[model samples]
Target: MIFLRYILLPIVPIYYLVTWLRNILYDFGIKKSVSYNFPVICVGNLSVGGTGKTPMIEYLINLLKDDYLVATLSRGYKRKTEGFQLANIDATAESIGDEPYQFYNKFKNDILVAVDANRNNGIKQLQLIDKQPDVILLDDAFQHRKVKAGFNILLTTYNNPYFKDIVLPTGNLREPRSGAKRANIIIVTKCPKDLSEAEKNSILKQVDPETNQHVFFSSISYSNSVISSEATKAVEDLEDFTLVTGIANASPLVHFLGDKGLKFEHLNFKDHHDFSKQDIIELNKRALIVTTEKDFMRLKQYESLKDKLFYLPINVVINDEVRINKLIKDFLKIKL
Candidate 1:
């Protein structure tokens, strides 16, 4: 794969030219970039997928939901529908995409959640609702140059930092490393709990964060045990269960389970993999099938295996709470 990437280096110029032109068009007003009246916090990454944007968005929602009317907007990736659609009581994982649907179901009463391919149109639709939200959170939209955001939080996985990676066709970066300058705050997601200050300093040296930009580290926290679908038999005693996950980053989950003294046979798959009937049959061969909450959203459609399947929900916890809280307060105080 390294040799193949080098062979494909010639296309890098073309990619740069195309991105430059698109940015130029928006910069010179040749193309319009729209902004909503509400304060928007954009959680995104320079890579294509799996930077833990969804969990980070959820973290922000949990932090700000009490003081502000929070709304979430996503591009509705891989959904069956199109255009701006407000999530209703009947919204399913298939209708508004798995991530947004999960948010809607979890925070149904307190928050407003919608999905749209066009960010501006989605914000407009949300504004037309009975009670407009004070703050809107845009999920996975760093590269959406057509919509201007008030604050951009760029996330790069700790294992695969963008500073060390090259562009697409050569590396996993969606844009050049310099593109990181656009981010107001940088977060090293999916880091280990024991990552030392010296190691963090080295990473900051590589990232070369500007004086104005704040940097923070975070790790994933999995809930205790898997919740059964029947809501009766709690699988807290997990001595005979198999772990099955289809996320871009499963190492953290695996490590967390190990530290808990829970033994599990893991079946890992590529990110965003659509589970099939045969997959469910093979998974059921174990005593129980365990998975992440994100994967559970996709797997729940398998009515045949609903009784046997269980999920372990996860949350994001910032390592440096003091610095994170201060930065958030400063940002919130700014008049956009």
Candidate 2:
């Protein structure tokens, strides 16, 4: 795969040029962009996937849902549906995509979750709803320049910052590193729990944020137990089992589990992999199965695995939570 990416390096410039030109058009207003009067905060990344975007969106939802009628708009990538679909009792991972469905499942009463590839249309649809949202959170729509969000939160992984990456094919970045300028807040996610201030200073130097941009570091916090439809089992009590993952990166979860001295055979799949009959049959053979919460949204739909299937929940633990929350709240106040 590494060799293949290097072999396709020549195509990288073409991809970069196209994406760069698109951003330039949006920047110069040559192409139209719909701006909202209310707060429209976007949590996205320059990379294709795996920068903890879902957790960041959930964090925003939790932060604002108490005082505001918060709503989330996702592109519903790879979903079977079309146009704007408001999540309701009948919503499934297939209908709204895994992340959005997860949001709906968790915050069904507290907030609204909707999906539309056309973000502008999604916002309009949200406005039409009986209970209009005070704030709309756009999930993974950084490159979707049709809708101009009031505040943009760009996420990059601690291991793979966008500054070190180039455009797609050769690198994971969807656009050039210069695109970071558009971000109001840039978060370095999945950092070590004990990351030193010295190292953070080094990273700050590498990032070189603009005067208006705020940089923060965050780490993933995993639940102490694995949850299934029937029961919740403590991580230490679990025996040998099957570890299944359908995400951009599973190494962090794998490492976390390994550190706990747990034993399991891994069945790693590509991000958002649609399980096949054969795959299900194989998974059914395992005595116990553990997976990520996002994957659980889709996997839980299968009746055959309900008894043994389990998932570990994860949340983003930002180093400066109070400050970040204040910044977001301040933005909302100004917009309102």
Candidate 3:
């Protein structure tokens, strides 16, 4: 893999130039972007995936759902269906992507969730609803420059900050690091629980945020129990099991489970991987199987594994959350 990355170095400049030109066109208004009157906050990343975007979106939903009519708009990646579609009782992971489907499963009664590759069209369709959302949360739509969000929250993992990386083909970045300037808030996700002040200062120096951007750090907090459709079990009570993960990065989760002195065989797959029938046949053999909440969304559809399959829930533990919550609320207040 390292050799392949080095071999692909020549293609990096071409990728960078293309993305740079696109951003320039948008920046100069050569390509117009639609802006709405109501609040539309975007949570996205400069790098590919695994920056805890879903958790961050859920955090915002939790923060504002009680006080405001919250709705989420996503591209509905990997879904069988296409175009603007609203989440309802018939929704499934295969219908609206895993993350958005997870959001609907959790917040169906409290918020509206919809998916469309064309974010501008999605927003317009959402506005046409009888009960319009007071605020719309754009999930993973930063590079979708066609629609301008009121607040942009860009996330990067602490271990692999975008500043230290180059563009795609050689590195993980989707655009130039300068593209981070568009974000109103920059969050360093997957930080250590005991991250020191000096370390934070070092990262801030590398980040070099502009005058308008606010930087924050967050760590993943794992739940004490693993949940399944049938029952919930305490993490400490789990025996030998199979750990399946189809996420961009599962290192943090592997480390978390290791720290708990648990024993399990890990079956790591590609991010957003679609499980084959044979995959289910193999997984059903295990006495107990553990997976991430997102993966559980897809796996839960199979009837054979319902009794043994369990997923560990995780949330982002933002440092100085009170301040971050205030910042989000303040932004919404201004937009309203």
Candidate 4:
């Protein structure tokens, strides 16, 4: 894999040039980029796979939902549906993609969730709905340059910082490291809870954050194990079972389980992996198969493994809550 990545390094320049040209067109009004009247908070990452975007979005929703009418808009990555569609009473994981569908189901009564390949059009459609939302949260949309967000929160995994990684085929970065400048706030996600000032300074040096941008660090907080939709069997106790995940990054989950004094066997898969029947059969051999909530959304459809699998839900816990809360309050004050 390392050798194959080197073979693809030559095309990095081409990727940079194409991205530059595209942004320049939008900047110069050669291509259109839309901005909505309501405040749009975008939670996205610079890399291709997980940087904990979903949990961060959920955090924001929990923070602001009580005071404001909030809605979530996603590009619906890898969904079967095309154009804009509101997640209705009958929306499933397949219709709006797993992440958005999960959000819809979790916050069905409180939030309006919609998915569209075109970000601007999706926002437009959402605004047209009866009792339009006061604010919109754009999920996994940092690189979607067509929609100008009010506040952009960019996440970079602690293990794979964008500065350390190269573009596309060479590494996981979807855009160049300089793209960090586009964000108003930079969050180093999946950080160790015990990260120190010295380590923080070192990472800041590597990220080279802008003078105007604020940087924050966050870690994953796992909830107690719950029964899988397919299986009615109680997980009994997370400490007794092995953990299995089909997610982009499993380190955070593994660490969380370890902290809880749980001994688990992790089976990691690529991001958004479509679990097969064979995969289910193999997982059944274990006493209990524990997975992330995101994976559970996709795997629940598999009738074969529903009874054997259980999912662990996680939340984003920023270490410096005082500072984060102040920053958000200031931003909302200015926007409001």
Candidate 5:
């Protein structure tokens, strides 16, 4: 597809101009953006997909959930459902999308997760409830200009910063690199665990954050155990298995497992890929199968794949925890 990429290079300027113009409208207030008294923290990326937004959102939830009534709103990507819908007992991966469903499942009875394509309407609905949340976390809503997030935590991968990338139809960026200026905090996701001070300074230099923006680096921290509905097993115990992945990037996971001296075959799928009946049959035939936490949320309901299906959980191991947490807290505390 390298040849196709070269062919698509010509359309890059068109895509770039369209996105740039849209941002200009949002920036200059030609388009109305709602600002709320309650804190709305947006964890999003300039690129199209998988910059560890989910883990970062979860991190913020964990940090503030105890002290604040926390709620999350997402676009509910690829779900069959439409409009504003708060997750309830009837909710499923098909209804509220995999990521939101996963959030509801994991944080049940603790946090509220809702989905809507119309973010402004979703916030209105969330705010209308009698037990209103003290803070709202907008999952993957940076580009949704209707609601101006109080704090924007923009994420990009360590390997490919947005500054070095071109717009869509050519590179993976969803918006122009100048869009990074809107972010209050910028995080370089998926850095090496042992990333050095000097290397981090180099990354910071490349990011070249504005005076108001704070840049941070983080790496993925994998759980020692793989979890299923019925049980959990140490990663080492699963020496051989089929790694079925429906994630944007699987390289970090592959390297992590390989480094642990594990033996496995990978069944790679696109990010947020939906499984078919035939796919289920094939997956059920495997002696053992492991998947991502997000993908597992979508696949777990298949009774055929239950006993063998397990998911590995991961968290973002920020380079400096104290400083980052303080920044988030301080931002939330602004005139509250």
Candidate 6:
């Protein structure tokens, strides 16, 4: 696959030109973008996937849910259903997608979670609700120019920043590196726990943020315990188990477990991969199974796997937490 992308490298210029022009059209107002009175914060990335979007979206939810009525809008990637859908009792990973379903299960009472491929129409449907949200967070719509987000919180992985990458087929980026200029805030996600000031400055130099953009660095804070519907167990207490993951990147989780001296065999799959019957049969052979919160949403559907299947939940731990919080809070306050 790595060789395949290089083989397709000639197309990069074509892909680059096309995406560039589309963004230019939106940027220069040749294409009209809808704006809302309430703050619309978009959390997205230039890369194709695994830049910690879900964790960042959850971070925003936790940050704003206490003070404002917050609603999240996402494209509901890989779900079976179509059109706008507000999470309800019947919601499932198959219905509204894994990440949104996770949001509904965890923070249903605190925030409203909705999914629609058509974000403009999604916002319209959300507006029609009895108590419209005071703020709407678009999960992954930096490229979705139909609705102009008031504050764009763009993310790039610390390991593979967009500036260091090329556009799709040849590399991971979904758009040209110049597209990052659209961001109000640029975050280097999945960084080292003890990221130093010198290192931050070095990364910032490479990212080359625009004059108005504020750059932040963050790492994943994994939970100490693994959760399942039946029970929970201390991560350290787990014996030999299979690490079943269907996420874009599993290296961080693998490294985390390794650092803890946990022993396990990994059964990796593509991101958002739906399990086949044979896949389940292979997974069921293991006595204990651990997965990500997103994969757990789909994997637990098998009754035979429910008792033993567990998932580790994680949060984005931003560096310089106080300053970052103040900056965002001030932006929201002034915007409102």
lDDT of 5 by residue, 1-336 (tens): 768877999899999999999999988999889998878999999998689999998998889888888999999999998899899998999999999998999886888999989898999999898888888999999888899999999999988889889888779899999999999999999988788899988888988889988998889999999998899999999967999999999999999999999999999999999998888988988999999999999999988888999999998888778999999888779836
Which RMSD values do the candidates have, in order?
2.3, 0.8, 0.7, 2.6, 1.0, 1.1
Flag regions of model 2 displaced more than 4 Å: none
Measured with C-alpha atoms, the lDDT of residue 313 in candidate 3 is 93
Give the 10-residue window scoring lowest on summed lDDT in candidate 1: 227-236
- Superposed model 5: Cα runs more than 4 Å off: none
Using all chains and alpha carbons, the TM-scores for the candidates as numbered come to 0.91, 0.99, 0.99, 0.90, 0.98, 0.98
Residue 6 shift from truth in candidate 3, angstroms: 1.6
Instruction: Give a tens-digit lDDT track for model 3, residues 39-145.
Output: 99999999996899999999999999999999999998899999999999999999999999999999999999999999999999999999999999999998999
Residue pairs of candidate 2 with colliding backbone atoms: none
Which order, best to worst by lDDT?
A: 3, 2, 6, 5, 1, 4
Q: Write the per-residue lDDT of candidate 4 for residues 185-284, one digit (tens) a residue.
A: 9999988878999999999888888898989999887665466774433333555666667677787767766866767677778877766678877876
**Displacement of the residue 135 alpha carbon in candidate 6, Å:** 0.7
Give one clash count per candidate, in the order shown: 0, 0, 0, 4, 0, 0
Candidate 1: tens digits of C-alpha lDDT, residues 1-336? 889989999998788677767777877889987865558888999886588998999998888899889999998877888899889987877789888988997898989989999888888898899899888999998888788887889999999999888778777888777778878889999888789999999998998998888899998877765775665344457776788888887887888778778777999988867677788788767777888787787787777768878888778989877787667656766733
Q: How many backbone clashes does candidate 2 have?
A: 0
What is the C-alpha lDDT profile of model 2 across 80-162, one tens digit per residue?
99999999999999999999999999999999999999999999999998989999999999988899999999999999999
- Which parts of model 4 are misplaced by more than 4 Å? 227-236, 239-242, 258-265, 281-287, 302-306
Worst 10 residues of 6 by lDDT: 319-328
Q: Which ten residues in a row are the worst by lDDT in model 3?
A: 314-323
Candidate 6 displacement at residue 29 in angstroms: 1.1
Task: Estimate candidate 5's alpha-carbon lDDT, on a 0 to 1 scale.
Answer: 0.91
Report residue 98 deviation for candidate 4 (angstroms). 0.9
lDDT of 4 at 138: 93
Query: Higher lDDT: candidate 3 or 6?
Result: 3
Best by lDDT: 3
